[model samples]
Target: MKLDKVSAGYHKKIVVRDVNFEVSPGEIIGIIGPNGGGKSTLLKSINGSLSLIGGSIFLDDLDVSGASAKEIAGCMSVVTTERVKPILMTCRDVVSAGRIPFTNGFGTLKEEDNARIDRAMELMKIKELSDIPYADVSDGQKQRTLIARAIAQDPKYLVMDEPTSYMDIRHRFELMELLKRLAKEGMTIVASLHELELALSYCDRLLLVYGDGHVQLKTPDEVLSEDLLKELFDLSGDMYRKVLRSVRGEKEEGSTSFFVNRACKSFPCHDVPESEFNCMFCYCPLYDTEDCGGDYFYNDRNIKNCKNCGFPHFRDNYPKVIKKLKEKMYGSGSQE
Candidate 1:
């Protein structure tokens, strides 16, 4: 499937424009951007929810411009992160809904439907959750069930929006692995991911929407290496690495504890009465040299060397100090 000169929006106000992309028969594509950047809007456009204002989408040679809902359903299956309506039924029943596209209006199930249902469960490795109440399962299990349902539909293209939104890090990786496997097995997968690293590693192509009008569709390496992310996100300095870094796992090795300057603040140090927390920070050259007037951030790039400070190990609630410090740091202090 390919999106050609597609401009999608609501009413008359355009959200994202001039998006041209192609999905191979068995490739994984990732659409990434900050919030309100129209990732979801583009997904909806292909999922048959949002109408396109210009350009045409093609599934192989067929035009998507005038396709009916059912006809489109025959080509693509979708699993959105939006909370699916809870049907008062077992997990099996909910996963069975994927077969509805194959069913006639009256909803008759064939032997192929049962075979596909079994394949879906086996593919998701959710035979254990089959008898469990759909509502009773964990979010990860539910997500897998919905994915299984989509697989059961047996559509050529699979569209997912934040499929791992409810999953933990472990489950998120697991889900990505599963999607990659499926793509290798001949399913066209398009997803919008908040996880940059995972997307860069798994997706063959990238679509970055910078909102309003700017959009870039390129190979993952090209987009990630060309400062496109920095421009798209308006980031600079060390913070730029937060976006400019490759989505794949290629981070540089550094100390887990960032060096501190002489007077620079640490996590949350409260002025306690005599004794609360007690720990000696590793001293750096700046402290002995008196570069920072006994502050932690002295003359080092790592902000090392602090003046020796003491605490009595008193009892200050960690949460309260953390809350107040965060409030101070992110609050009106900077502007004032």
Candidate 2:
């Protein structure tokens, strides 16, 4: 998919500009930004749900800008955060809507439609909800149902806004993993995501839209670089240092399996519910540690048993770590 100079927002003024980017076939590109940063707007523009004032979107060789809604749906499917045209519908009916592109305006499903719907439900792991009333299900289930509907469309291109909106960490990771597997199986996907760490760790590429109208398109590795993240986020000094440290945690030596609980003011892994531990938590030193075992994490100062922690090691030389981090930030600068 190709996005060229795509600019869009309410009232026709561009909230973001000069957004030239491409999504390679069978690759996942994550669109991320601060709230009101035009992340969702960009996705809508590509899916043709929102008209763009200045640009063209192409899926393969087809120009999405000039295509009808049905034509666009023929090549692309979308799962939006907003509940559009939702009065009442069963999960079965919802999933079947994905087959609309091939059906008449009223959508008469064929036998293959039933099979595709089943496959979509199995993929989304929501087959049990097929007979359930979508309106009565929880948001997480509804989100999955809508996604299954999108999957049933079987379009080469899939677009979603905050696919993880109502899911837990495990479910979120599962959804992301599904996208990755689907990409490997030859589907091109672009989704707006709020979970920066997950997107950076999972997506083939990351597209950051800065509030100032500048855009950053880079691989996850390039986006992780100090200069890139600092510029993309307009972060500096302490905040920059903190975020870098968090990002840096991905490179650490411990298991990233951890969680941050609100009350203990600490993240204890031992108590994480099975439903909760769906692998959403990062086990790196950024969040917590797993070496000591049982709910003890790196955050909330759960380093009570780790000897390497800055205790006597940093009793007098504490500034060394921060200083070295700063030097690393400059690429070639030395503390001396």
Candidate 3:
């Protein structure tokens, strides 16, 4: 798939302009940017869902703008964030809809089509939910079902927007791994991801879209080495370093266990010495504990108020905060 000088938006208004990129076969390309930065608009243009305001998109020499619906559906599959409310449909019924483009006029499913549907359900780990009502499942299950539906289409190119949105950590990892396996098997994937860590780890290349209609396609290493994230996201010093460390899989080396975001408007949220204040626990970790060992109280609405608490903000209390969190997550006996 290739985009040449493409510009797209809603109804004659251009959101992203002068975009030029090409996605090769068996590659995983990730689109990432701040919210409302035209990532979704670009995706729609690529999949021929939204019309291009300027330039052309091509799928192996065939212009997407002029391609028929069936022609486009045969080559590409899409999974958007839009929720589909299919009344009286089971999860398997929803997945079966993917075969429409390949089926006869009455949409009869053959044995081969049924086999592909079963394989898709298995890949997405949604076979257990196949007999359940589509509306009765949780959001994560619904997202998985939709993914399975897209997989059943058996298109060469897969396009997804925030595919991991409603999934938990384990499912998110599983989905990324599945995408990698698909890419190895010669499927091309283009996805917009809100999770920077996953994009950095899994994507073959990153497309950074700026709010000012500027776009850059680069490797994850180039993005990190050039410090583009700091400029793109306007991250604070501490947060930027933390992200860098996380991408590199490096641990904090020194005795510096605390961070202070002095640039914050709410600097000194608690009255403490500037030199000793620790902003590590900006929101207290012990807020959920009934006996929180901090100066807190319940409001008239039974809300736990920590307006005057400074226990977690002191530099020396870092170990205590970690211990408390461990005890809360595990049993007290598990705390070292």
Candidate 4:
């Protein structure tokens, strides 16, 4: 897929301008930016859902602007953020609609179409819900059913807007893994992601859309090393530092994870090294955990006393502390 000097927006107003990029086969291109930065507008332009205000987009040699709806649908499948209200349609019925482009005018499904629909449901792990009404399931399940519908289309290119929007942490990772596998199988994918960590880890390249209508295409490393995300998102110094650490999965110099306050009278609260003490978590996050990996004991009234625990204050225990907190909040298998 290729976009050349594309400008996209609603009505006559332009939201994103002068966008130029090309997505090669099997490449995962992530579109990331602040909210309302026209990521969805750009994607709609590329997918031919919205008419381009200027410039052109091409899928292979086929010009998107000139292509018929069926012609475009034959090569590209889209999963937009819009919620579908299918009246009385079963999940399987919704998925079967993906084969419409290849079906006869009467909308009769062939055996091959049925097979593809079933396979798509299975791949999305929604086969059990196939018979349920589309309106009855949860938002996450609806999103998965839509994704399965897109997969059932079997198009060469897949475009998605916030594909992980309604999914839980585990399902979000699962969906990204599935996209990776699909890309490996030669399906080019372009998606807008709100999760910066997933975008940094999974996308081969990022299409950054700035709020000022400027866009840049860069590799993940370039986006990180150049500090483009901070500028793009308009983050403060401290928030930017935290975002950097979160995406890189490494603690950098002057990281937000480590802090010290020496002015307090009880400064050396823990018996640990003052230089390595992290005051970020001044109060132990695991204080409520019954089996917290810390030196804690019950007081005379059976109330827990965490004053002797230094687990949260240790510099090296930041990740451990965060892990314990997340486990307490969302269970051990959670990724959020």
Candidate 5:
């Protein structure tokens, strides 16, 4: 896939400009930046969903700008974050839609198309839910079903928008792994991600889109520097320093995690049911310092027992953590 000096946005309003990148088969490219930085706009342009304001996009030898919808669908499959309210469709029905590009005008499914759907459901680990109503499934399950739908399309390129938004940490990693496997099997993948850590770890390349209309394609190592992150997200000096330290693994030795949480009783105050919610820290700010110094041991069941330390719960200790982390990163307050 190639984007040559592309510019894209809504209704003639430019969001991303001069975006040039070429990706090969079996590579995963991640588009990342702050909110409204044009990540989605760029993806839409590449997938031929949104018409480009300038330049051109080519999928191999085919011109994406001039291709018909059917031609584009045959070459590229899209999985969006938008929820599809399928009135009476089953999960199998959704996955089967992917075969529409190859189907006849009568929309009859061949045996191979059914086989592809079955394989896709199995790959997404949604075979059990294939017969289930799409409306009855959880958000994470719905995401997986949609991904399966894309997989069944068997397109050369797969595009997604925040595919991990509804997943827990486990399933988030699982989906990344699945995408990597699919890429290795010869599919080109492009997706936008808010999870910087996951993007750095999983994607072969990163496309940074600045809100000011600056865009650049670089490797993960080249794009993840402190200066670049600050510029891309327009972060403050303090926030950038803290993020830099965290990314460099320069935390206070004993501080495992630090977060302020509202102690709402109804908000999973005991255990974490999903990765989006951190119930462990709900009462971290109120823990008995004398009982726990913030150190804990995980037992066979992976249950935490932080009854000997309070290292991460002290709100007043943030400055100390920052100081220590900064010291570790830049060598004991010696400014660079």
Candidate 6:
């Protein structure tokens, strides 16, 4: 799919201009920037929801400008940020709606359609909620159901806006993984994301819509610079650096502590509190380290378990932890 010199927006008003890019099969592209940067408007242009003020979009030889709604629906599916309130409609019924383009005039589902719907629900892990009304489901569940609908549509390209907005951390991770799997299976995906980490980790390329109709298209690594991010979001210096460091796994010197306790009866919630038990390192700074040599394991839910690790509790280990953290923060043997 290709967009050439595209300018688009609501009726007679242009929000984004000169947007150009070609999407390859199986590539995942993420659109990101500050609010009102015309991300959604650009998406609308690609999906044919908003009319293009100038230029054109093409899906191979088929001109997007000329394609009928039904023809376009056959190749593209979109999950927008707009919440859909489905009255008296079950989740199954909602997912089945994706087949409208392929269904007969009366919208009857065939055996193949049922199989596709079943597969989509299973893929989204909403099979059990299929019978529940859409209005009764939680926001996260509803989001998943809508995603299931998109999947049931079986379009060659899938587009989503703020897909993870209502999802919990676990669901966010799961959904990204699912999208990656789908992309590997040859579906092109274009999405607008608020989570920079997820976008950096998942997208093959990123289109940054910095308001005033400016857009920059680049790979994640190319656009992950500190200055660009700070400018894009209008972040202050300290915060911009802090956010960058956190995402890059570089700990600031004072971000963690060695030992100190304010007022605590329990002192140690897991076991008897040692007089010297330090509350400073209550949350281990090295929790994110893969080979910190601490005795740690992940629980059933994949949460890190450091209950038996005495590395952070012992007062003497404070200096060593700090040293390791500093080393991680400022590379090994560099003046700290």
Q: Give the lDDT ranking, best first.
A: 4, 3, 6, 5, 2, 1
In the range 31-119, model 1's lDDT, one tens digit per residue, is: 88888888898888888788888888888876776888888888789989787758676788878889898897888888999899988
Model 6 scores a TM of 0.76
Tens-digit lDDT track of model 3 for 80-120: 98999999999999899888899999999999899999999
Q: What tens-digit string does per-residue lDDT give for candidate 2 at 140-259?
A: 888888999999999899999988899977788789889999999999989988877778877999888887766778888887763576766667778877866665564332123332
**Local accuracy by lDDT, each model:** 0.73, 0.75, 0.86, 0.88, 0.80, 0.82
Residue 214 C-alpha lDDT in model 4: 89
Itemize residue pairs with steric clashes in candidate 5: 292-309, 292-310, 293-308, 293-309, 293-310, 293-311, 294-309, 294-310, 294-311
User: Which segments of model 4 are wrong by more than 4 Å?
Assistant: 250-336
Error of 2 at 303 (Å): 27
Clashes of 2: 11
Model 4 C-alpha lDDT per residue in residues 1-336, reported as the tens digit of each score: 899999999997999999988889999999999999999999999888899999999999999999999999999999999988989999999999999999998989999999999999998999999899999999999999999999999989999999999899889888988999999999999999999888888899999999988899999889989999999999999999988877765323324577677896566655567877766656556675454645665556554546545454578878888777777778778555
TM-score of each: 0.71, 0.73, 0.74, 0.76, 0.73, 0.76
Error of 6 at 179 (Å): 0.7
Q: C-alpha displacement of 62 in model 5, angstroms?
A: 0.8
How many angstroms is residue 38 displaced in model 5 relative to the true structure, after the best TM-score fit?
1.1
The residue pairs that clash in candidate 3, if any, are: none
TM-score ranking from best candidate downward? 6, 4, 3, 5, 2, 1
Clash count list over all predictions: 16, 11, 0, 0, 9, 0
Every model: Cα RMSD to truth: 10.5, 11.6, 13.6, 11.4, 11.0, 10.7
Query: 250 in model 1: Cα distance from truth in Å?
Result: 5.8
